[model samples]
Target: MSELRFVVQLHRARRLHYDFRLEVGGVLVSWAVPKGPTLDPKVRRAAFKVGDHPMEYVAFEGVIPAGTYGGGDVIVWDTGAWVPYKDPDPGAALDAGELHVELFGEKLRGRFVMVRTRRDEWLLLKKRDEHAVAGWEPGEHPLSVLSGRSSDEVKADPEWEWRSELPAERAALRLKAEDERTRKAEDERTRKAEDERTRKAEDERTRKAEHANDTEHANKTDHTNKTEHANKTGHTNEAEHTNKAERSNARARKSADKHATTRERMGEGARASVHERGGADAGAPGPEREHTRADERERAAESAIGGLESLRNEAGLDAIGENGTWEVYGRRLRVTNLGKVLFPGRGDEEAVTKRELLRYTARIAPTVVPYLAGRALNLHRFPNGSHAPGFWQKALPAHAPQWLTRWREPGSGTEYLVADEPAALVWAANYGGLEWHPWTSTVDHPDRPSYALVDLDPGDGTAWEDLLVLARLHRTAFEHLGVEAGAKVTGQRGIQIWVPISRGPGFAETRAWVEGLSRSIGAVVPDLVSWAWEKAERGGRARLDFTQNAVNKTLVAPYSPRPAPGAPVSAPITWDELDDPALRPDAFTIRTIGERLSTHGDLFSPVLHTQQSLPPLT
Candidate 1:
């Protein structure tokens, strides 16, 4: 039989420990070694048997988001092949409560025996062998042999780039967007450089022609003609200037060429590394199922575009009345009751009409779409205007357009209108969708969330400043764990914080972890924050709600237009702004928010791209 591969990982979880895993039956049979490995044969380390992990996890070296199972930073401390000692049938020996294995590793090289003390726990002992020394230190080599990164380094930046496989159509769409952005930036740079070169060339040609004319005049005219001779002297002076300019241009060209060469060399090296890592196939066709599915989605997208085109031709500009026709995502949207005022004019504030609402959604779509796109949207419609009572609508309305994408939560069988395209947002807004709440998870994986969200709701006695204080504490706590969180105004009297994380651990795990985190924060500052679910027991402390972590639960998305007075938006704020004493939750109104976005350009975008895993709290 072939020798089995083994790995000993140093896991800095809720408690610092070592995990010893051996390849058995195609999986890594794992055990938690609390005290870690020792070279002394007399000393025994308590090894608690744990669940089997996939073989691929042997190379994993990153943070597990706080709400995930065994959420913490893990690094491969020792790894190598293991040989069975005496007992050829290691499987039988393991079942009999005694198994001997000789490890050949960088840090660990010796014969070890594991004796079962209980069904779930075992005692790991070093055998008295030639390789055994008087003392062995587990902390001697603390960094990972593969990455050369320490546990602290791994925790600081958990750069986990691998995402769960997305639907081929979605993947292609995302890739196309990224390529378009890069191409646009490159084109702009090239255009400017070309313009500069053309101007310089024209100047050089004009100077050369003038010099030739001056020379011709000097050679043909009499030598005694002072005017022509003077012109020749002037031409000579111009020639010197031209030569200097040419030399300067040559130096500039040489410098530009050198930089270009360096960039090209770097690009070549990057491409080679990508090729080695199997990223060279990024442009190639994916699996047959992905291809077939992608084709179907493409056809659907085409049909949707066709429907929009037909509508555009039908609704001519002349045919529009108070109900104006606006084109969005290539779709002509016929907005009716444009004169209908959603929010009445108050004092200096002008009346906000349905037309303005539609306009706001369209204007903010560029900023809003990045956060709301792919998320299952829960529409809060106010058909009779915001003054009247509005109701939440999770399901797509019966009158919803056929072109809109629908999302059905797996297993739950709950269907929702997905704002996958920009047009959907306009369509919903036109239908009186005043408030847009999107689930933390996306349509691609409804069950797995991208963020672990915490909602801070202050009690009656608590003031807005208290909320700020509590938010800062939470931020510091997360920073201590080496995880960065994003804070945003809820457009109400509260604040919300989100930590972007991987999507493998479901809601249950995340919720439990968040609850524990909330309690810990509450414990630290009992006067400021409370983990109580009920307002009665909250005792006026700010309640940090972790309940929004459920799969179906939704949060008011960033840049979403709230139905508050002045139509304030739920805006993301920098951590530095959190300490501002004058800061208020609804300070960023719809009228002023556009300017903030233009200046900052989506501060919360990193929360979508940065993958941070939650390390088990120390």
Candidate 2:
């Protein structure tokens, strides 16, 4: 005896059934189970044995039409070899009413047992062991070895039949049952419609009765009012009085009618006026509604304005009063009393009088001083001797003393401190000498006063390379222009180049020339360099930063202390030291500059106001 094999083609019929099948004697034994196969061995599920399908039916796939008996796409749900445990033969298993087989399907795998519960019903249960989980969980299925299609497309073939013999007894009983269901459905619909019509009719009748009662009451009141009016008139003669009374009653009624018409006209006029004003009707809101909307908008605007004011205050310009000005360095300003304060340039051209300057300072004091605190700016001071108060002392406590300088301008009788110097230069021979007073004269060569401050980062090899390339490029460009250029080590990896120019060119032009020179250098070394602004791009190559020339930006004054990234000041190193690669950029610091100043006075002090001639750019 050989094991019986079976395969069932399931349409599922819909989404909720299982097409049960078994392979026996090379053909698929089939059944359709509404509840599907159960894992509980004790549960007997009804399974009607369908006629066997051809072996090729295992691959059949297509949609079935709607409203047809057992209509659905066909799918091979399960298939595997099987052998009866009782007799070990195909026919013997049917006779014994029990079967055992190893099953395989899209969602079902491993051994299963089917035992007959009745002549046409059986219980199919999964054998739990190493191949099964603790309980049967939905959607757990092995790959469909039988269907060879996705589980989502699994269906039962519409043509598959469960039995060849027609059960006349069962068909007759089912037909009677369906007829009874149709009758019940029709009765339910009729009853619902009748109930709705009755409800509507009763409501209409009740409303009409209420209207009739209201009309009768109104008529009675009108008659009583007419009688009262007639008695008040007091008619006398019989016939004449009767006529008068009738005429009086008619007049009374006419007057009442006129009054009613007037009231109605007034109401209509009022409604028209409301509509013209865009007011709502009886169901609409009034004028207060519009007021509430406006109020909301006003609050929103106020909130936005408040935020803007707070931002302005943070920028430190909020306190600069209108019509007030201050002398910053040597420039004079005249600020109007408005949001944007203006600096109106030097007053009288010969330098503003101290009295006038002081008055302007006092006017803006309460408003501008708070914002000026802690910000660094240039300041000039008068020497300790001779007449008027020293420039430093006269400026008052509002000015910081650190930036003030004392010096006398050429051809001036009185010695005065001037903070606005074009350049700071130290002759190489003099080294620590201060007597040269290189910047004192206003008539010196224009090229003698300009300087360059290069910020360098030597810790990065690439940054150091970039600095060297820029230094060389700058040297070449200036040499081409016939400008006298001097280079010195910044005491770190960076170098400073000084180009002397006359005083009259102003800081703006001087900065422009520097920017032009930087650009020229950038053009020559595009690969290893770029401008500072361009360097901010992602993965950008390093370049010279030209914006450092903008007005109000002060470079560290020579001999002035600066805190370098992490180290002491390199001070002013000799030109030779700059060529050495070992020098680090972090050698400069504020502490080092202070120490140098105490020991050597200021090396850059003499160069403060030396007049230099600036030739026109060629």
Candidate 3:
């Protein structure tokens, strides 16, 4: 008899059952077998005749939803070809009441016989054969022979609709990746094009400069020839002609030099332009572009005139006892009496010099400039030494460099120093800037402060612990209104808490909000905190000086060095640190603050970024 394709599907419906299918007449002649197949010669399993199913059902393995026909998990248990035991026509024998077959499968291999015991009911028995054993069972191997999936895995398979979207999702991700590559390539191409344009422009400038130099040389040569001819032709007396020719030659030399200088300047301009565009300066002249002695001195008198390396070198070049000019980041500033102690000796310590102050400002500029930039400076000038009395100058001194940006007050006509960049800070240090106090508002919005400050000015009896408690109370009030507040040690004897707010509200509105917040805090700690504006009414409690949020009022900015003996900074602290009992006002000083900053960058940066509104006052 011809061997036919056979499949055994282990199906799990309300009860577990095995579907035995044999390919016959272009369809699968199916039967449902409970207790599964057995290879034991003595064992017999009950089988119920089922209707014909599609031949393709041999490979199907998945979950069928509940309430559907034969709804349950189904998996292909075993599949292989089978041959009739002895009869040539097994289909005719199957119709005749008894059918016998030799089975070959991953899990079932033996001589099996099916005999009709009743209407639509048959007994499948394993015959005594070489492949049959006394205790062999198919139920011991429950996984699908095709997919290795068990009944539970088949049951948990997701719906086909959801699984079908994976290919499309993968395609979209591939397209997005390709688009990003294309965009990056386009950007590189555009950058190259711009670079090429800049190079061409620089080449043009070089050519023009060279042409101008050549013209000047030619004109000078012609003038010299004319003067020599006049001397030889007897057109004028020899002595007088010689003197005139000398003067003419001098004029020609001056004119040629002027042209050469102009050409050099043109090349410099081209180089600067290229640098600004971040393009290659291949055509730029090298060390030959060094400024003349006059230009050098002029620039030195103006600002520190160099890059980082140059600044570092110039910083050490000056003698301590002399007045000299040095370049710092391409600007020049004059420093006098580098050896003179700006701050006198205290206890076992010696003193801090003017140069030390400049170096400190230069060293801290990268971090300090951002805090001071765009904010008007109230300089605490200590022209003598730190021990001597220093005066506060709201207006920048007349000697301030022209490069320094200044903000003019509305009615007072006071021009305040604006440390717009690192160089400006260096200039301030040259002007004996011992302490930096920046206005609450920036130059962008002088009347509208970016944050409201609650300066905790402690009375004689007010403890540091009480100030910490008050700071927490302020934070609580701010959080209740959905605002984020930061705390900082004042570097002096007190503390300040700051809440970032939207810039749309003027200082008046912010001050009012601060006042409300202060009142709420005062009510919470009535004995320890005071909201009264007057210092006398604080009853030895810490004053919540909300007036510091007014338009022109300022608190010591974060990271700003105080003029104290140890150069303590007004350092920003996390709320957790603020709550620590060991947190001291003088914990972070200039000497140690730099290391902390390198580890934790700009902790108070949120003050310049986050925006929040105050809740309506009750």
Best candidate per TM-score, number? 1
lDDT of 3 by residue, 160-204 (tens): 111222332221111134454676567556556444543455445
For candidate 3, the TM-score is 0.48
Question: What are the per-residue Cα lDDT tens digits for candidate 1 across 1-618?
Answer: 444678898998799999999877767888999888977677889999999876656545566657657777877777655767778887788889888987756567668999999898899998875446555668766877444567898688653311224331221111134454676567556556444543455445546656776897877756557556767678566557768655634533343335224321111222233334453322222366334534443433343233333233223322334654455566645567977888755458997887667666665665566677788887777888878867565646434656788875442223468887778888988888888888788888766788888988898779988888788788777645556567789877888888777667776567668878888887877887655444555677777877677645667888777776677778877665675555688877666666455434455654654454556877
Q: Ten residues in a row with the worst lDDT in model 3?
A: 167-176
User: Which 10-residue window of candidate 2 scores lowest in summed lDDT?
Assistant: 426-435
CA deviation > 4 Å runs, candidate 3? 1-322, 344-350, 531-537
After superposition, the stretches of candidate 1 with alpha carbons farther than 4 Å from their true spots are 1-320, 344-347, 530-539
Q: Count of backbone clashes for each model?
A: 2, 48, 12
Which of 1 and 3 is the better model by lDDT? 1
In lDDT terms, which candidate is top?
Answer: 1
Error of 3 at 88 (Å): 99
